[model samples]
Target: MRLAMLDLDSYLLRAFLTVAEIGTVNGAAVKLNRTQAAVSMQIRKLEELVGVTLFSRSSKGLELTSHGQIMLAYAREMVALSDEVGKRLTGKMIEDRIRLGVVEDFAAGHLIDILSAFRAQNPKVEIDIIVEPNRRLAKLFEDRKLDLVVCDITCLSRKPTLIWTEYLMWTVRSDFVADTEKPLPIIMFEEECPWTLPTIAALSQRNVKWKTACVASTLVAMATAVRVGIGIAPMMLTTKPEGCRTLDRSADLPGPVRIEIGLYAQPETAEGARYLVDFISRHTAILSS
Candidate 1:
């Protein structure tokens, strides 16, 4: 019965916590890297299995019914526990190796400061910092190949907590302007970019069509394309590339596209896990404030 009740994936638990954090099936889908349909079905299945209505649709988004809210807290705790187990079981013992992965966007931003402080705090811990695509980074985390990742909070991710949200902006060359007919010539990271969904959604809302003219898997490639007028891209407001200028659409742009940067660790090792989480929490104040 226990085996039947909770599959290793804990899809129901993830779905519940994701809905609570993002406030919509679509949003949860992005974090989970699943389709909206898939997320909806998962939620439905979870609700059916548990025999409770977890959420109610709202104009703002999805609001948790009181029952949903109560369950959400429990679900989050369970998921965190699972991740802690993974963290503890994988890799060398805690003091020996601390493998950290981060998205390139943060390489130029506050990551350096954070790492520097971390090293100062834990002088004996060996840290390996890997810069990779968002998807790849998350995969490493899931595979227990990485101890922690400092990357944009992707909709597909179920492990990360909401650290902070960053404003999204469209960065284009100074001389670049969109033509009336063509969808913007987009230069994007090859399928692994985390913010790709928001970009697509914003364009869809504006009735602007777009095509990926170039696909480079790295931030540098995408930035180069934007600099040379390949296409405009939505970038984090906190960290903009050197030459790119913000584009003004004269209307409300898609949003304060919130980019959440978070940390992940195995759930079973609360002592070590809490240490890493607390480390991030302390330095994360700079971003939020």
Candidate 2:
């Protein structure tokens, strides 16, 4: 006797993968823009077709079953290939344009290299990039003026497609000395910058006297200020300027700080936007490092 072959639906595979990644039907439904009932029905259908339970519920929510663990890899590949095929067949990918917004720190760091690699693979896809402060980027994203954005997560209210934790340190010129008796000289971005309030709050909570030494409109200007021995500023570890050093624990300053940066995109964005989002998500670790 001959065995029948199963035909898997791409839609169902996508639904399964989203739910697995998000770990809840409700969350997946919101991400997929489907009703909760529809996503639940799709998961049931996928489980039935596979003849194995995909998820086991616990107090923490859905946990993948052993079978689901095995299926996850294959589902990801299939869904990606399916999307690739659709894009290739329609020939719309080459004509697609993606408007992307990013915070200045990322733009000054590994963003160019990442974009270069992406452009090599997607040569014809036009990318218009806006480099701005996180608050401005978040506003642009909220207004739907950009297809995707990478900014400080604290500035945005929505769940990000991907998140990276960046370690921030109190940075100062290599030869700079602190006078404990005087108000600490501090470098700061404009008041609307996402880092400004937290930086001030941290100083205030520590009861450290601080006075603004330089008010910079951009990261480069801030770095220049630090290099010129203007004041101490919070800077990401991975992107600290060459002439600066982080304040040690013995220094009378806030302890080490961490901030979340995220890539944001709406679920209904265009394929080019989704492709860029996926590309960025895949290389997040390298970008952050």
Cα RMSD to the true fold for all candidates: 11.6, 5.4
Best by lDDT: 2
lDDT, candidate 2, 1-289, per-residue tens? 1115667898999898888767789989998999999999999998888889999998867878999987776776677778778878888554579999989888878677888888987898899999988888888889899999999998997767667787668899999988868998988879988778777877887788889999989888989999989998888766688978988765467666667888888657887787787677556657766
lDDT of 1 by residue, 216-249 (tens): 6676776777777778766665566676688775
TM-score of 1: 0.59
**lDDT, candidate 1, residue 126?**
71
Least accurate stretch of 10 residues (summed lDDT) in model 1? Answer: 266-275
